[model samples]
Target: MIFTLRPYQQEAVDATLSHFRRHRTPAVIVLPTGAGKSLVIAELARVARGRVLVLAHVKELVAQNHAKYCALGLEADIFAAGLKRKESQGKVVFGSVQSVARNLDAFQEEFSLLIVDECHRIGDDEDSQYQQILTHLSKVNPHLRLLGLTATPFRLGKGWIYQFHYHGMVRGNDNALFRDCIYELPLRYMIKHGYLTPPERLDMPVVQYDFSRLQAQSNGLFSEADLNRELKKQQRITPHIISQIMEFAQTRKGVMIFAATVEHAKEIVGLLPADDAALITGDTPGPERDALIDNFKAQRFRYLVNVSVLTTGFDAPHVDLIAILRPTESVSLYQQIVGRGLRLAPGKTDC
Candidate 1:
């Protein structure tokens, strides 16, 4: 099947090509959460002269991107061990960073273009898996070009990916991963164009903990373990919050509740309507998680509680109500959480 891009998406592709021609360096494309990034990636692979490697942080994204390529009549191979796939010399390869990080040497083929999905995750740390893989690949393919795609381009403390510079050490004042942002589709533009649902922040307070006392981690965010412990103390108060959420989202069709930890998620599920609510976390088995997500998407459940699972690649347009039970300082995390409900639905005027 032939695929077509929206006007802005095509423009983004054109801008990326022009930047590469002029500067010959890595570039990033900042598109909204619901924007068709995979389409731009597909078009890139279609026009590429050599092999293309699409790197995603999660298996879900790797599969999602590969599926889009396949629908567009592109032959793609998966490099994720979790999916039981091996590296191949396919023209297009969808790779999970976690799976391929350890086996970079296994992929002997030198790719001409490296498209990083959710590329904002490439941190400043030189020893990070992303940097490690790139460092190794640079020697093999000196002329390899990078194309980063992300909704949020800035890190917690690293400023923007384009201006990321690490000082003090062996690699002081190092070059950033991307030369510049070639294209940016702002959230306001997407909302104004009716491509995404306009979010309405509910004033209901979900947690009642002394967040000020929580110590921050290196990323300038509260430690997950500490936050979870604090959240656990509020388990007894979840039923009240659930009741308030139910009242606030009375007319909404689907509700997604984000929690700090698996135990907190379980507590939320216990408080919610047992027959209409489900919980999923990183620990949940793959089959069970998929089933829960499928059920939630099918509208079998009015509420779905999750912990660090349903943030990015998961799409549920009917989720008009988002109860952010988990508080996060990371702009990317906040965007992803709110973005779960940003896809435009038939009657979804407010998110």
Candidate 2:
């Protein structure tokens, strides 16, 4: 299949090429979720002569990226754990930082380009697989170009978008390593673009938020160093809370409930409107996990309750109700989940 890039996406590709011509160094492109960032990167991989290293963080995301680029006529290989590289000398390689961060000696400097997905995590500090990647690249492929892509470009601690300017990550920065690829498509923009449907949402209406008990548990009323023991006890009472959500979302189509733990996910599944709910996590085996996502996308399931596993790099266009039972401090994650619901439906925006 031939790939036709979007206007902003094409602009990003052109800007990346221009940057490459000038710096011959890796660069970052910040684009919103569902903006077809993968498609752009995939096109780059298709045209790349030498190896192209595409590094994603999660296994699911790694798999998603591998599939996308492979579809672009780029012979892509996966180096994730439990997955082996193909015999095809494929020009594109999708590696998970979790899978290969500690083993850079093997892939170091081998590829001419390094693509970091969800790159707001790269930040100014040195840590995580990102820091490890920079360390390896600086030593091995000092001239190796970096192409970072993310929806939100700021970290949790960075208060303002202006900090991105100072960090030299924003296009506004004079010493910017990579110019802004495109920040035009926020979730709202995606909705206007007909890529996502606006979601229906309500603040979960429970008489109580389990506040006092949570405070007590935190202040040491529990025997465990963890909060699970208390959270589970509290969730047993959540069935009553589910009734409220059911009533509020009764007319809504699909819902995703994000939780803190597997047990929490399980309880959410149980409390869901029944017969149409499922759970997904890192623990779910391959076929089953894939099925859940497929079914969710196919509208076979109306609800999917999961942990942090599904937050990033996951998209179900028909999902029109975002039920956030999960707590988050990161803007990147918050925007990511919200972006999932912003794709415009058929009558509205771009395909």
Candidate 3:
């Protein structure tokens, strides 16, 4: 089975290959959320020389990327504990950082290229799991090349993920993980090219929650404790917000609601129709979470309320309405949350 890459995807692959030819420093590729990054990863792996290892922070991403690579009639092994597999001898291997970091000794083979899916998650902390894995891999192959792919290159409190962007879109930090951004695909370009759904923001709601009074932590994000206390005081307003969401969702096919916390998610779910809604949090059992997500994607329910779990790896293309009930200072997080609805699905003209 052969798959053809889109023009922009091929361009991304070309840019990455071109970057590696000129420099040995690590670089990143920035593509919008809805873009087919998995395909690009697969293409790069196909053309890459020597053994390749693709790393993702979550098991879902490892599985998804591996599946895409395999769909091209390629053989690749998955090294994620969540998937109950840990084969590392294949020329191309997809792995979750946690699993790979824990069992670094299991991998006897040396890899030439290391690709990180959500590279922005890599911080300057040398003790972090990603850093630990990279350090080990670098020891195995000192000349190893690193490539990162992500939609949002900026971290929450930190600035850019790369020290220098291709066009200097923004200032980069000296402590950034990746050294440069070799290629970037803009969200506007994707929308203009019909590759993604155009997002439409509704007018200000009649009832709104004011997060201005909440204090910010040193990380430039609101503390969950402060948010919870403030939410408790404004508990009366949650119903009004849900009411507006419900009214808006009546015309939408699929709706995803992002809540501040688990308790808030449960409260919102309780207010919604039980049969038509479901709640998912980090604590939800793995099998149960998978089932809930499967059902939601199958349109078993119209509303899915979650807290921090569905921001990155989860995918539901039919989602036409995104109700962000939480507040965040991170531009990356905000874009990720809203990206859930930006996928171009049949009958979904806009989000």
Quick one: best lDDT, which candidate? 3
Candidate 1 per-residue lDDT over residues 1-351, each given as its tens digit: 987789998998898778777766777898989998988998888888888889998778888899998998768889998778977579888998887788987777788888999998998688898888787767679888888999998777676677421121121123667767777888999999888888877675664535666766656556678887786666567777888988887898999998876767877788887898998888989888988888989999899988888888898889999988766778888888899999977777887
- Please give, for residues 229-347, the per-residue lDDT of candidate 2 as tens digits: 65666665667666776776566566777765677678778777567889987788977887888988888878888776787878776666676665445566777777766665444
How should the candidates be ordered by lDDT, best one leading? Answer: 3, 1, 2
TM-scores, all candidates, are 0.92, 0.79, 0.97
The digit string of per-residue lDDT tens for model 3 on 1-351 reads: 799999999999999999999998999999999899999999999999989999998888998999999999989999999999999899999999999999999776789899999898897889999999999999999989999999988876677788887886656866777888999999999999999999999854587888989776655567778888889999999999999898998889899999998888989999999899999999999999999999999999999999988998888999999999888877888999999999988888999
RMSD of 3: 1.3
TM-score of 3: 0.97
Local distance difference test, each candidate: 0.82, 0.67, 0.90
Residue 85 accuracy (lDDT) in model 3? 97
Q: Candidate 2: lDDT of 333?
A: 76
